[model samples]
Target: MTQAPPELPLHMRRDHFDPVAELAEVRESEGVRRVTSTFGMPAWLVARHDDVRDVLADATRFSNASQLAFSLPDDPRSAEEKRKALAGQMLATDPPDHTRLRRFLTPEFTVRRMRRLEPRIVEIVDQHLDAMEAAGSPADLVPSFALPIPSLVICELLGVPYADRDEFQHRTARQLDLSIPMPERIALQREGRAYMEKLVAGAKADPGEDMLGMLVREHGADGLSTAEAQDGAAEITDDELAGLASLLLVAGHETTSNMLGLGTLALLRHPDQLALVRDDPDAIVPAVEELMRWLSIVHTGVARTTTQDVEIAGQHIPKGELVLCALPSANRDPSFIDDPDTLDVRRGSMGHIAFGHGVHHCLGAPLARMEMRIAFPALLKRFPDLASALPFDEIPFRAYHFIYGLHSLPVTW
Candidate 1:
């Protein structure tokens, strides 16, 4: 039989609720260590909180755009297709390029905007909760509750047909799974782009009130009246529109869905914390923050390529190298917090790099927080005695994937 690939490198390893013990050991002993990526590319893993933050903060030294230059050997896409793939991707660009795209999107994602969508989000959460109750106990929370809320929210926000969610969700999940062959993942990515391109065409024909419509109205080829052009509204190509929409569609749902699924599991495992969130209105906010800090679900953050020779924690790394920040490890570093391993929902508003840091911090942070803030407390209040249907060990974890989360969480109340 053909041998299985080696286990995920230490930076990506997690033991359910915590980073692996060895990861902690490495963080404390050596702030930066070399490791092979899931794709078998060699990289420097930055583990300490400070060093990771510095790597994330200094985009000039660590270039996101440079990292995009490194492509999978198995990828068969033409140079043009690959260029289209990176178009308008905020995470894959640096400085002015990222700033330009982000400026158009920032207005759409502000805290004020999230407030306007709050009622609809609450409606979506309740709709799912009602469905879960009607379906009775032992519901797989992953599909029944955790998955649909954010998926529906993103679908509505992006003006994608909710009817097509199953197809897009399947595409994104398969594409993000590191275990899937790289070529197959690239194909799924292409399918997603094709799907979004069709939607972009529709938005161009007639803009709706959704985000895609907003983009088309403000940045589409025919966009920007002379006055608006002066205000920085520039005409964007169809590929950029499709690329931006595709990025939002994948990210807006995937990260939050996993947070819901994995966070619910974390809460169920700690009943005391669960009760705090369920019983007290104030507790839910802090609880969400703590859970996010504890769960740092994005596995290793986006890889950065070094622009020049750099020294981190007294270790010298030469120019043009890949640097990976261990988000979970950095979040759990003892120096970053007291009793770093323990879960305490009462810790209010600590700075955690779970959503990443600096210029590339997650743009959907407000929307995600709003969803979780609404969904978590609502689920707990709806099912006060919520629980795991199986032993912890029996629950499946998405261990080898780029994002860390539960594959399915069987629950009962």
Candidate 2:
């Protein structure tokens, strides 16, 4: 008779800001431990900061492209169809292919580009702040302020119509919710792709000054020159463009919006730290970094599979085995920082892997940082006495989603 695998601890979002207590225990005793993934697959969960960085940094040894059937056990889509749906997501590719795709898109997200958008970002933040103020005290911060700034900025960047935000936002939320069945999530993915396909078609017909138009103009049928084709520019296809666009549209807004909502709640809870960020102009940048490290809103780093047998923190993980990093655990690991669990706005928190580590590190770090740095202080200064409208315990956190965040943050001045 064979022995059954041990039951794994739940790894979904938490109702509170803290990571599950079990992760802290595992990090201390067994930095790399075998656990069952939410998808029902066996995986090695790396918790310590150093070990997590090692796994993420070594792309050759840990392949991001290794297809783990994270889909529901009853998923109706075939493997090939699923693969096609995930094809152009930068997070799903590795090395040469990843490098190629990133090269084309990176120029658009550089610090210089993000700086150019900063004035407009500040304007958008103020506009939302204006709306929140007009509504009087006791407003739901998520919809009133948190969601709109990033949503509008990304819409302008991608040339996506702001009027269509609700549809895409709904689809993104459902798709990231772990409780949503695989079949339903797949349907959402298809719907998002169809929407992007229509947008890509429009961009190809008459290119605008947005990212989509730039992509179509540089890589589309009418765009690529013979020399450009020789350099692999023509390799991009309409389907691939749609996939890429959809990924950007979803990722650009969802992650930042959640950060804005969750970060606000965090600062409200830590009044001293909130005062530091609100009162000191110099503290704003480092405060954003510390908040990212402290919150680790993206609960899991992208999952990878071992390319060969590997030893991580004394555990022998076999070739092709699934591997995941518990980001919240790593960010809060005592070895990563002094008083790791405390929210300190003054600390630089520069080395934390909140944006992740190595090649797949977040491309939009500059943009996200600018948004947070601008939005937090502005909201704080605008309403100096902002406080939670509901009891902290009563405020619902998004416990079912892969990206941890608040469902809504009710606040009043």
Looking at model 1, residue 134 earns an lDDT score of 93
**Pairs in clash, predicted candidate 2:** none
Tens-digit lDDT string for candidate 2 (114-189):
9999899999999999988988998999999888888899899999999998899899889877767676887998
The local distance difference test score of each candidate is 0.87, 0.84
Global lDDT of model 1: 0.87
lDDT of 1 by residue, 1-413 (tens): 43464477777788778899888887989788889977789999899999999999999999998986787779899987788787777788888777877887899999999999999999999999999999899799999988889999998998999999889889988898777777788999999999998999999999999999998887777543333332444666777778788989989767999999999998888889888998999997888888999999987777999999999999999999999999999998888998989999999474998989989999999999999999999999999989899999999999877888889999899
Alpha-carbon deviation at 88 in model 2, angstroms:
1.4
Worst 10 residues of 2 by lDDT: 1-10
Per-residue error at 158 for model 1, in Å?
0.8
User: What lDDT would candidate 2 get against the real structure?
Assistant: 0.84
lDDT of 2 at 343: 86
Once superposed on the true structure, which residue ranges of model 2 sit more than 4 Å away at CA?
Answer: 1-9, 13-15, 68-72, 222-235
Stretches of candidate 1 exceeding 4 Å from the true structure = 1-6, 222-233
In candidate 1 the C-alpha lDDT for residue 214 amounts to: 90
